[model samples]
Target: MYQKSLVELAADLQKGAYSSEELTRACLQRIHTHDERLNSFVTVTETQALTAAQAADAAIKAGTAGPLTGIPFAHKDIFCTNGVKTSCGSRMLDNFIAPYDATVTQKLLAAGAVMVGKTNMDEFAMGSSNETSFYGPVRNPWDETTVPGGSSGGSAAAVAARLVPVSTGTDTGGSIRQPAALCGVTGLKPTYGRVSRYGMIAFASSLDQGGPFARSAEDAAVLLGAMAGFDARDSTSVDRPVDDYVAQLNQPLQGLKIGLPKEYFGAGLDTAVGDAIAVAIEEFRKLGATVTEITLPNTHLSVPAYYVVAPAECSSNLSRFDGVRFGHRAANAQDLQDLYTRSRGEGFGSEVKRRILVGTYALSAGYYDAYYLKAQQVRHLIRDDFLQAFAQVDVIMGPTAPSVAFKLGEKADDPVSMYLSDIYTISVNLAGLPAISIPAGFSNGLPIGLQVIGNYFAEARLLNIGHRYQQVSDWHTRSPQGFE
Candidate 1:
């Protein structure tokens, strides 16, 4: 049951091949038996999951079920779940049970999906590796010593390990796509404002977008269909009608125009990963798609610009979590100011503190124009680069990460090197465009992801492209050895 794709599982449930309760039990059992090895889950709601599964079974019997009914999936810890510990992988919120559901949580629940657990992630979504998580790192199922990528690493690792067929993740700076590449899964980061961000703990409010992780593009499409829509409460959410992501999954790619950026294939990309991407391109060509070379000139400035912009937003959004309100509070203090100092000092991890400090400094009055304003200017250039490329091509293709998963501590001490892990992805967020990462191939047994970027609100087109490639490829279907 765990081996089946989400689409397959949904069909099985609808056909009465297996009850939702039975599948949910199998998933829970797998988590208990193997998750300690991966540290993927921060919380497992066995009682609630079983109860939800029973409700789903009743819905199906009453012939009132949706596509995701009875499906068991995990939520990234960053999304608040009512009555569940929505610890954003930070000690500050370790004991904070959410009083309400995030918009993503509400939508999934309405779709009849059962939440099995909340997956671990980087503390405050600040780090490139899962090592910054307060609960400890989430191990890559493909290679335990290597990172699964962050801040959505746990969600990616859980799906890769088959602990769940599908799960939710938030990508602020390649969190969903990078980990998906390392874990050999299909992940999508929808256009900004395409998915509601309400109730999702903010990292970089502008860049943080909730998405899905699954074994195939088809599964991602199904999840996206349920997860996306206009939300009146979320001001950032676009007031646009949602596309039928699943309905377009099988659209032909015969005339697809794929643009391969010269920068993406240049220095820094792993040789094996580049070669894998080359082969994947040929596969698309065989499917009758035309490939062309393109340039995103401002791509070189993406990393630096992202650091400044993302941190600036993070600093502002995280200000609400002071000692006075909910979350962690200092045990005792000499005064109110001291309480604020101690609470934040003791609550946030080193990486989180580093980002917050940098953010604060960038947004400081005297330095605002020099750093924050300039970064925003560079961000515009990056967005323009993508706009120009999109004008010439239907979609842009590249390696999701410059390399395969690195050893867990390889870049932990070197923050610059860690930031570069998202070099290929940050530009999309800057442009607020839709993108998808699918398994391209592996490099020395580790997986590589082929990123597909489309114009804003082109999620359906992006998923259709991914689904077409998946039809001819088996990379997404392969599982980590022990888990299989």
Candidate 2:
């Protein structure tokens, strides 16, 4: 029952093979059994999930349930669920319980999806590996010592371990795709503003967009359909009509032109992972995609530019966490300065502080133009490079990360090395395009992911491409051995 995709589970639900209560129970049981090792969930809403499952069961009996009725899924802890602890993997928010549901959460609940739990993430979505998380790092199910790539690490780990069929994740810079790559799952980062951000705890607001993680592209499409749409609450939410994502799953990719960015394939990418991506591209060629080498000239500037831009935005967005408003406050304080200093100094993790410092420096008066404004100009160039490449190709493909999962503490000492893990993914956020990462194959026993990047609002095409690849391969279907 746990092995089935969300689409299959939904079909079985409609066919009366199992009740929502039973499905929810199965997921809860799995979490109870396996989450001790993976540490994927921050808070398991067992009572709320059971109650919602019962309601879904009632709706099913009444013949009014939607397509996703009774299907179980989890949300990354960044999303604010009314009365649930919406910790963004930070000590500051450790005791915070939101009074409102994120727009995405509201829509999914309305579509009858059951909430299994809230998954773990990096502190304020700052790091590549899950090590920055205040709850502790999430272990890759593939190998217990290996890290599940992060901010969305818990979401990918949960889905990959089959604790849940699909889960929600937000990507500021590769938070969704990179973790999906390491955990061997499917994750999508929809076009910026396509999915409403209301009530999703802000982290680099302009770049943070939430989407779904699932075992297959079809399941992702189903989840995306329910999660996306215009939300007046989120001023940036595009008012365009939402498409039936699942309806477009069967679209073929014949004659599609896939661009392989020259810079992505050059030095620094691990050979084993590169080989796996090459094979995946070859398979696409066999399926009738025309492959061409393209150049995203500004690729090298992406990481530096992202560091400057993302942190600058993060510094501003995270400022709202001052003890007076909400979240953790110091137990003892002589005055406002003491309160702010003690609260923040104790609340944030090392990496979070490091970024806050970097961001504060870049956004400061004298450094503003040199760092922030310059980074913004470079960001424009990066986007322009993609625009140029897309003019001649239907989609771009690359390895989601340089390599597969690394040991838990492997890069923790070096922040720059950790930042580089997002080299291939940050550009997509910088460009504000749609991208998806699917388990392509494995290298040295760890999962590797193939990144499918589409033009603006090209989620349908990316999903179709991913669906085609998944239809021909079983890599996405393979689970971590012990978990099954």
Candidate 3:
């Protein structure tokens, strides 16, 4: 019962196979049994969850429930949940309870989904691995010694461990996809502006978009449908009509054209991951989809360009944490500068601080043109490359990460190495394209993910592709042993 996909669970609830309270209790029980070592959750709202579940069960009995009614899901700590401590995985917001709900959270509740807990994340959503989280790193369920990719690591870990069937994750430069790949789940980073950013903690505001993590592409589609839409509170939110994502999940892939980027298969990519993605492409061909080799020449510059753009925006957005309006404040400061320095120094983790410094330097007066402005120009080139490729292919395919989950501390000491883990994913964000990571295969007992990149607002097509693959393979349904 615990292993059921969210879609199956929702159906079961609708048929009275089980009440929402029973399902919620089972999930809470699973979290209690497994979360101690996983450290996936920062807070578990047992009472609130049960209350919500009971209401969902009553609604279903009354024939008034929505698709997600009685379904349990977790939220990344960065999303502001009313009356809950929306820490954003930083000590600065440790004691800060939000005054209101984030647009995403509010929408999920409206859909009758039960909020089980808040998952841990990288401080200010700033790191590639969960190691930078103030709550401590989220260990990959595949192997306890490996780090789940971040800043959505905890969300991925929770889903992977069956603590929840689905969860919300915010991606800024690969946070959601990378972790989902490592943890063996499906994650979608929707086209920028497709989802509202209102009440979500800022982290490279231009790049951060909240999406869903789930066991299957169809489930992700349902969650995405619920979470997406225009919100007047977020100026960047797109006013486009939301599509019926689940309705398109069964679309045939017979005439689909998938482009395999040459740059993504070159040096630095792990052989195991490469082989797995190659096999997935072959599987796509078997599904009657056409595969073609394409080139995105500027792909090599993605990391450097992302480093400049993400950090510069981050530095500007993060300036609000200067011991002024909200978050942590320093005690007994002699002067204003001391207060600012000490508060930040005490609140942020090492990676967050490093990014702040790098961002500050890049955005500084003398260096803005050399770094920030130049990266913006390079970003346009990357976007142009994708636009050109999409004219020839229906969707793009590649390995989500260069490799499988690495040991927890493997890249912690080297920030540059950590940044490269996001090489494939950062480009998607830069282009503001929709991309998803689905469990493709495993190597040495660790999961590898196959990424599907689509044109702007092409989430439904990506989901169709993923759903077709999932129908033929059980990779996405396979979970790490001993966790359940």
RMSD, candidate 2, Å? 0.7
Candidate 2, residues 1-484: lDDT per residue as tens digits?
9999887888888889999999999999999999999999999999999999999999999999887899999999999999999999999999999989999999999999999899999998888889999999999999989999998999999999999999999999999999999999999999999999999988898799999999999999989989999999999999998887877887877899999999999899999999999999999999999999999999999999999999899888888877998899998799999999889988899998888899999999899999999999999999999999999999999999999999999999999999999999999999999999999999877999999999989898888889989999999989988886
When summed lDDT is taken over every stretch of 10 residues in candidate 2, the lowest stretch is 244-253
Model 1: worst 10 consecutive residues (lDDT sum):
317-326
Instruction: Give all TM-scores, in the order shown.
Output: 0.99, 0.99, 0.99
Candidate 1 TM-score over all chains jointly: 0.99
Give candidate 1's whole-model lDDT: 0.93
In model 1, the clashing pairs are: none
Off by over 4 Å in 1: none
* Model 3: pairs clashing at backbone N, Cα or C within 3 Å: none
List model 3 lDDT by residue over 146-247, tens digit each.
Answer: 989999999999999888999999998999999999999999999999999999999988788999999999999999999999999998999999989999
- Deviation of model 2 at 12, angstroms: 1.2
Residue runs of model 2 more than 4 Å from their true location after superposition:
none
